[model samples]
Target: MDFNMIAARGLVLLGCGKMGSAMLGGWLRQGLAPGAVWVLDPHPSDWLVAQGVHLNADLPARPAVVLIAVKPQMMGAALPTLAAMGGGDTLFITVAAGTTIATYERILGAATPVVRAMPNTPAAIGKGITAICGNAAAGAGDLDTAEGLLAVLGQVVRLEGEHQMDAVTALSGSGPGYVFHLIEALAAAGQAEGLPADMAMTLAKATVAGAGALAEVADEPPAKLRENVTSPGGTTQAGLKVLMDPDTGFAPLLRRAVKAAADRGRELGQ
Candidate 1:
């Protein structure tokens, strides 16, 4: 797909909150012009206003890509406004959780290309993983278009099917909270082991960050990397014994949490 084509076609970002602003920043960081983006927000930001980007309360034009970043609950109100703008050729890329492609088809018509994506809060820092899926109407170029738009924020992977979107939502979408809790747990453990509170927190944060970076860039499997660090009767092994216990450790808790999130996502789609 020619990603260069999307920039030439123009784009509209509906809603400009934290995630929206982050996506905009990522695009600008990747060299997309501020003029190529038309923003629609009820409350415009001072910085966005100063960038020469349009910030109207209503739809201004029919764009090649109409990114839906508003809260899912606002879909009913927003859809009509977008439809009125005549987004016939627009590829609808919705970041709102559980808003299925069927909903977009119902509101915008079946011919419109719709892509559903799950992007985590990490995208705010340009280190996110986005899962993308699209409908039958999406052509080869449409997938490229959606992927290119999402790639502006972070890594993009196309899901096998839209059903997997719920799982993606459960994993990467809600995964940041789980990682945050793990960092907190590690910090508390450090404090218990006699480290100063401030130092413990600093260590935990850096350790988590470094570990994540290693996992991302490493060619070895995570288990192998983990085993390489664990020595016979070492302190790390002793801690791992508790964390890796099958009946009561991290796995069961994380599995339950992901299931709960997936179930809630399914419910939200209905």
Candidate 2:
């Protein structure tokens, strides 16, 4: 929690979109000195300026951390200006999708230390979980620093290898959309079963939210939790039979969805 490094050299935030703002806000709330952060967005919001962070100003000779939160499509244009920032003690942490460590190293230099992270949309509220992977040039200290900074958003998990990043992108990065879709599907089904439209939507939303919260705190696995709720020959059991059907089940459907996402990620990286 010691922010001496941030205070001394400052942190560079390369983007100020929703995710970037959420992370920046969390950092400030968690004790990162506001004066020690720099905002690099081309069009700064009034709210961003009011936060007392340096905006589009000259940077220090060496920053403590440079977070690349710009869109992947913008990297080619943005990274050229950052070439001077590489090959030093500076740690370049990128959250841009499909921007590989090799891509960063090649743009910066072979000696540049880089950590790649995939954080989901939930990070906007500080409830998101992040998957982190670092290149060989990054040392233990570098990884620790990156993880600590990212923890401001939510949970942090370190991956053994960068190769697993695609899976991480598929599962956690795109997982929120899947959950949101489930809410929509459940709401629609509730309506189909004669529940009022608005009431069904409210129930669906609360149910999914409550269930996810419970799943997090439960000591038992989800399957066990399902069994705990089902009574023999009950309505829940009848529903389970159809939901757990091998050919049309949740597992196989989600497997196909995750695979589609992961494949697109690999293609983007290439």
Candidate 3:
């Protein structure tokens, strides 16, 4: 999407940490006006200051958008300063997890247009996916604007309702941790089979990375890909027998794990 309009209008970012910096870098790369952006953070990065962004300065009388990239815990401190900006034409988008759209409305105003987003760890490297939901006050244009801004980070998926965000948080928000653990487990298993420690780790990391890249470009489903790799009685098939067990396989384990994460997200919302 053309970002010329977004670049022209002023934008205020509430944080300038890793994820926020990654997002800002992408926007600048995509033609956002450096002079039109303002960043607010207690500890501003040298890189951010070098990029020509207004750092810790008095905000514009009214920015076109206010993006909250602070931690969920820092919401109290960062949001109070911008509460007045809400309930107006200026849209508010947040990447803070476990903070619902209702909470922002309560702090800002019932009519505030708030968009809550959940982005994963991969966002730090521009490989993540984000799920977003806007409050009742948000319209098609508002959501479109939010998506355009977030598309810089990675793939963007819009949710049907705010409630679905919990499922999204469970799946992708915490998914990187699960994938990292899988890498560790694979390395440990390889070590048990007598592969050297460093070699096992290298193999585990490369295997997972390669597989994910393949899946991203593959034309067929994962099941089809798996079948193509498994010979009549090969090592891949032997591993599949253990991993595909209906009762004890990855399905049941991942189901419980994701449910727990979703439940925790709901609890945090309260």
Candidate 4:
């Protein structure tokens, strides 16, 4: 939460899309001077324009950090804009998926401190979890700085190595989508059981949201929490019988889903 260093040195944001704006909002709320931030976005939002930040302005020569929040497809076209500021103390932190540290080092200089982060879409609401890993050129101080900035979005976890990022991407990065799909399916099932469509959807949404909130604050593990709800031969047990089936249940299904996602991530990184 200490903004003295970042405030004094200035911070450059390469893109000001949803994720970028979310992080920016968090920073500003935490008392960061808007003048200290210089954002470079081709299509800046009206909200971004109204924030009083230096939008599309000339960046500082040695800014404290240059956060890349552009899409992975746009990275090749966007990164070179900040090439001049690379290979120095300015730490480069990228939330762009599938872009590797080696690619950044090759483009921005091997000496540039780079941190790769995978943050989910929930970051737009400051309720996401982000996993970060730094390249060899990045030092402890650089990681600390990156973690501090990203913490504004949500919880931040440090990875032991960059290789773990793929699994992290599969699990937490794409997890929100999986949960959304679960909500859709649950609502559909309820409708098939004679509930009205709108009522089913509302019930499904609240059920999932309440369960997730409980999981977040609960002291016991999720399995234990589930056990607390299931009776020997009650309706919850009947539902668990299908969901926890040995051959065709959530465990195997989710394993395959996560593996497919991780495989695709590895392929994209290649």
Best by TM-score: 4
State every prediction's TM-score relative to the real structure.
Answer: 0.93, 0.98, 0.97, 0.99
Q: Please give the lDDT score at residue 219 for candidate 1.
A: 99
Predicted candidate 1 versus true structure: per-residue lDDT over 30-131, tens digit per residue: 777877788888788887788676677444456788899999888888888777544377788889877888888887888888888899998888789899
TM-score, prediction 1: 0.93
Ranking by TM-score: 4, 2, 3, 1
Residue 144 CA displacement from its true place in model 1, Å: 0.7
The per-model lDDT (C-alpha) reads 0.84, 0.91, 0.90, 0.94
Residue-level lDDT for 253 in candidate 1: 80
lDDT of 2: 0.91
| Candidate 2, 23-131: lDDT as tens digits | 8988888888888998899888788989998899888778988999999989999998888989998899998988999999999998999999999988888889999
lDDT of 3: 0.90
lDDT of 1: 0.84
Candidate 4 Cα outliers beyond 4 Å, as residue runs: none
Q: Could you give candidate 4's per-residue lDDT for residues 1-270 as a string of tens digits?
A: 899999999999988888999999999999999999999999999999999999988889999999999988899999887898888888999999899999999889999999999999888888899999999889999999999999988999999999999999999999999999999999999999999999999999999999998999999999999999999899999998999998999999999999999999999989
Better of 3 and 4 by lDDT: 4
* Positional deviation of residue 31's Cα in model 1 after best superposition, in angstroms: 3.3
lDDT sort, best first = 4, 2, 3, 1
* True-vs-predicted CA distance for residue 234, candidate 2, Å: 1.0
